[model samples]
Target: MNRLFDKSIVLACCIAAAVGLAVDARLVAAFCLGVIATSLAEVAQGNRARRASETASYVYIIAAVFVPPFVPLAPLAFYDIARRVRREHAWVALGIGSVFAFALIADLRTDALTARTLLLTAILSVAATLLSLRTAQLEREQQRMRRTRDELQERALALEARNRDLADRQDYEVELATLAERARIAREIHDNVGHQLTRASLQTEALRVVHANEPRIAADFADVKRTVDEALQLVRASVHALNDNAVDLSVQLDCIVEGARSDGGPQVELEALAEHAPANVANCFAAVLREALSNAMRHAHAKTITVRCMEHPSFYQLIVTDDGADATPASSSNVAEGMGLASMRERVEALGGTFTAGPRVGAGGWRVFATVPKPQGDEDR
Candidate 1:
């Protein structure tokens, strides 16, 4: 848009100079040619192109001196130069206008210079200078507006990036809090409900043993023990649901085995093959492993323990074996199991699994084996 407007101004100046030269002498026509060339040069160069174009406007002012009719074109050239130059160099345009005024005054061939002629020249020169200064002011205002727009765009981009980062951090904090809450609930169930049920099972088992001679009383005690075992299984399932299994099952098993070894217990080894399991399944397995290891280390006086995990087509299995004294003979007969074994059994069975713990039939050690069916849809994955 600016380019087209500049070209129009240059064309108008050329037409005016051509008409003026046609009515004047040949010498005046030749001088007007110089004015046309300088004006064209000023128009051809862009605002930010080079400093060489600035000199063309000064040359135009000199050309206008020899031809009075071309003086009107001087203000246009001055305005162009002012728009391009800095405010500190603004005096250059006014100085060129002053030179044009002096040349006009001196060019009068009359014996005496009239006040009317002098005043007219001064007014024309002052108008051209003021026009150029106004152009320079508008240019400065435009530059300031452009700078402000660029700054606002950059600030908007920075603010958008900051908002995205803040949103991501907020989501992370919420997830951490949720996981912490789930872990707390799991701990509460284990420490409270699990402990109370374990004690009840033990007492019920003791009552069964004391009433063994009375068949009816023993059967009633057995029924009570069965009810307690069922309640324990439900509590374990709830605990397993509350636990978040973000950690891999294999990593958790390794930590458990390492902890037993660090405590100066029997030499413990773990071999976990199943990499992915449902959260509830993994939690039940962890509980069973912890209880089995404790029983082997504390009651059986095992010298070494081996923990192995296997993945089947429809189920996952965990086996913990220890080179320890035989399991209590009563464990095979269902004649009142200990708290550790009973708790392990309940946890595994609660997840629709089978659990067995006793002395390995031809071996001199105890082995606890559990097999839980994979959740629907997880068996294939």
Candidate 2:
């Protein structure tokens, strides 16, 4: 807009000068044609229009040679040539030389060779050329500023991403420190308080045994022994609770998957590991996953194994499947039971859950699935 406004002002001044020269009707029509052609040449963008504009520019120069009114509009031609000087030096020289030739021809033919007319042409041409050069310089400055702004914005985005990473790392460290502290506390209680309680129970049992011949004293010692036994149980339960609370299931499962990956045997992917699972359930699922992977590696010679665990409202479920071609089910539809399968079954059954390991129906793979009901205590928690 600013550039166009500058050009508009120069064109208006040229028109005002033409009016002062008392241009007749023919001169007015000639003036309009030259103005239209030169303006189109100045603003033309595409190649086709630019070619047509160049032709019009030539026509405008030719018209100026015959029409005296067009003498003032010579500045537009000079401005266009000046703007292209850096890109087309030879064309600019030719264009400028043509303008001088046309101006000289118009003056000689019209017999109006005045000092004022020459002075006016010189001043307007210089002014229009300066405007073009100034506009080009401004555009270069704006481009530089845009590049700097874009670079600064990129740096700012990178810094923000780094800050987010640092924040996440800090949060993980704090969580690790908290878990470590809890483990330390649980260990201290087990070693100190639990040990002391066990010793008390043993000592009381000895007293009860020693006083068995005396009815009254034996009864009293037996009661004390029972009391000490109950205290010991409470201490053990408290220690277990502390340890369970410290367990991070996600971290434990991640480590298990990472260790399995290091072996470079069958590819292992943890399909899922459910959240909000009790510590015992998490441990059981992880153990089942490890056992299944081991069996697949040794006997099944599986290509891939997938481990999935989920905690439902009523039960926790685990599924470990493997694509082991060598270890398909027998004709009777029974896969041979192994010690590892037995252990997993026992673990789940002990927790009031069901466990199954078999050749996947309608598939060329083995599937080990287990589902344990949510413990009463865990449900309450």
User: Best TM-score goes to which candidate?
Assistant: 2
TM per candidate comes to 0.52, 0.55
**Residue 219 in candidate 2 has what lDDT?**
91
| Model 2: per-residue Cα lDDT over 232-337, one tens digit each | 8888887777676435566677677778775668888885546667555666676677667767766688879887776566787888888996463221122365
Largest lDDT belongs to which candidate? 2
- TM-score of predicted model 2? 0.55
lDDT of 1 by residue, 129-220 (tens): 46556655676789999988877865664454345435534654575577679889999989998999999999999999999999999999
Cα error, candidate 1, residue 288 (Å)? 38
Q: In candidate 2, which residue pairs get closer than 3 Å at backbone N, Cα or C atoms, i.e. clash?
A: none
